[model samples]
Target chain A: GQQVQQSPASLVLQEGENAELQCNFSSTATQLQWFYQSPGGSLVSLLSNPSGTKHTGRLTSTTVTKERRSSLHISSSQTTDSGTYLCAPFNVGDNSKLIWGLGTSLVVNP
Target chain B: EAAVTQSPRNKVTVTGGNVTLSCRQTNSHNYMYWYRQDTGHGLRLIHYSYGAGNLQIGDVPDGYKATRTTQEDFFLLLELASPSQTSLYFCASSGTGVEQYFGPGTRLTVL
Candidate 1:
């Protein structure tokens, strides 16, 4: 079975500071997705980057398929960005299954 | 908007009781999945279906059964539930792409 590991299980930062989260997988991945889980536990997809760097607003995701690793960067974080960030990667042969990381809990202080 | 909705956002059941978690996706996706999220284990897939009347076992399918009665409906059944089964359950749907849309989640507690 494939496994996904996220770095810095938890992090806290000032409102204007930048945050970086890392994700590493045990096997080759065909698709990589970043998700934000609100305090109430609702999940929202942030980005899907399998091999290249992608940016949406102040969040950026970079994935290196051959390296089996990915990263999520948040710039000038705000209090509303506080939540758990999850990284999931789809195994090469598994179409409907995704290997999920334990998640990086971020807290943006005022 | 395309979305996935789950029923009975919260549930409480006794040990050995039967519980059913329902999920409906208006996105008209062919692939639907059931996952459970715990404190440190993250999200583990329980079951999935590619289409109506189709079912596939996931990584953690023990003591659980799933049914896809229609393209828009998927159900997770817990027959004789236990306390260990108490966790937040999430239902997700995806089309041909890898991106999956998740439901609000159902918090189930087995007493």
Candidate 2:
């Protein structure tokens, strides 16, 4: 079975500060995605970066498939950014079934 | 936008009871999935289907059954449910890509 581990089980940051979350997988993954779950209970798809780097707004995602690792970076974090971030890896030939990380809880203070 | 809708956002059932969680997608995706989220285990895959009238067992399929009857509907069934089955369930849909869109989620509690 494949395992996905996220670093810093939890983190607290001051408003306007930067945050970085790491995800490492035990096996090779053909695709990787980052998702944000808000306190409002909505899970938003952030990025689908299986390899290389991608940026959307103040958020950035970098995935190195060869190393079986991915990272999500938040710049100038805000109070609304407080939530849980999950990383999921899917095997290409497996019908997109995902192996998810427990998630990194991020709290931003005003 | 891709949308996945789940019915009965919250549910409470007793042991040995039968429960069904319904999911619908308006995006017309070919792939649909059901996953359970727990405290420390994250989200575990229960079942998935590539199209209507098809079902595939996922990583954790014991005590769970799934059915996909139409392009827009998928259901998860729990027969003779137990307390251990209590958890938050999510339904997701995606096309050929691996980027999945999740539903609002259903919180199920088996007493």
Candidate 3:
């Protein structure tokens, strides 16, 4: 089965610093999604980038399908940004086949 | 935006007990999925359905059974729950396998 591997399983950063999370999948995909989960909360979709760069708020998602990887960049991080970030890549025709990453646990200091 | 809702956001059951989790999607999405979330396991798919009356086993389907009674409803069953079955569960729906939206989630504890 295909799997998603994320770098820096856990991270701690200062409030004003920037954070970059990486996601690498084991399969080819046409679309990939980035999700955020606050402590003890539900998953929230951050972005759905096809193959290039996408921006939402201070978050930027860049997907390179040919490389089977994507990255989520968080700029000017805040304590409220503390949470887990996950990524999933799926075949467009069969989104149900997507693989999920364990996620990058981020903690921002006040 | 997609709306996925789960009932009884929390549950508790004893070993060998029976449990059921319910999910409803109003977006008329054809793809629905049930997943369990553990500390390190991330999210493991337990089952999924493409439409009403359709069921597909997911990667982690050993102790779970699911039903899709209508286009808007899906349910997961645990006939004999165990301690290992305790985890946070999420229900999601996709309009076409893309941009999946999730329900708040249900925390189940099998004591």
Candidate 4:
């Protein structure tokens, strides 16, 4: 069974601070995606990066396929960004399936 | 925007009761998936389909059955619901790429 491990299960930061989340997979992955799950449990795809750095607004995702790891960086965190961040990596052989991480719970305080 | 919509945002059922969760995707994507989210388990895949009439077993498909009647519709069936099956279920659709668009999610409670 393939596994995706997320580090710093939970994070707390000031509104203006930055947050870094790490995801390490047990097996090789062809693509990596980051999602933001609101407090209401709705998920929204943030970015999809296979091997390089990708930026969208204040969020940046960097995936190193060779290292089997990915990182999501959020700059100038805000209170609205308080939610769970999930990392899902597509399985190497099966592109239809994604191995999901336990998610990094982030709480940005004012 | 890729839209994935799910039905009956919330459900409650007794043990052994049959429950069906519906999903519709307007992205015209070829892949659809059903997953359950728990407190510590994150998101666990229950079933998936590459296209209409194609069913693929996911990691956690024991207590669930799924059907893809059309390219825009997919359903997950819980023939005999149990308390342990209570969780937030999400339906997602993706195309040839790796980005999966998720629905608002359905919260199911079995007593």
What's the TM-score of every candidate structure? 0.98, 0.97, 0.96, 0.97
Model 4 agreement with the true structure over B1-111: per-residue lDDT tens digits: 889999999999999999999999999999999999999999999999999999999989999999999999999999999999999999999886378889999999999
Q: Return the interface RMSD of the candidates, in order shown, one decimal each.
A: 1.3, 1.4, 1.1, 1.2
Q: How many backbone clashes does every candidate have?
A: 0, 0, 0, 0
Q: What is the C-alpha RMSD of each candidate to the true structure, in Å?
A: 1.0, 1.1, 1.4, 1.1
Model 4 error, position B101 (Å): 0.8
Question: A2-69 in candidate 4: lDDT tens per residue?
Answer: 69899899999999999999999988888888999999899998988989999999998889899999
Give model 3's TM-score versus the native structure. 0.96
Q: Each candidate: fraction of true contacts kept?
A: 0.86, 0.73, 0.73, 0.86
DockQ-based ranking, best first?
Answer: 4, 1, 3, 2
lDDT of 1 by residue, B18-101 (tens): 999999999989999999999989999999999999999999999999999999999999999999999999999999547889
Estimate every model's Cα lDDT from 0 to 1: 0.93, 0.92, 0.90, 0.92
Error of 4 at B36 (Å): 0.4
User: Using lDDT as the measure, which candidate wins?
Assistant: 1
Candidate 2 lDDT at B38 equals 86
Question: Once model 3 is optimally superposed onto the true structure by TM-score, how far is the C-alpha of residue B59 displaced, in angstroms?
Answer: 0.5
TM-score for candidate 1, residues paired by index: 0.98
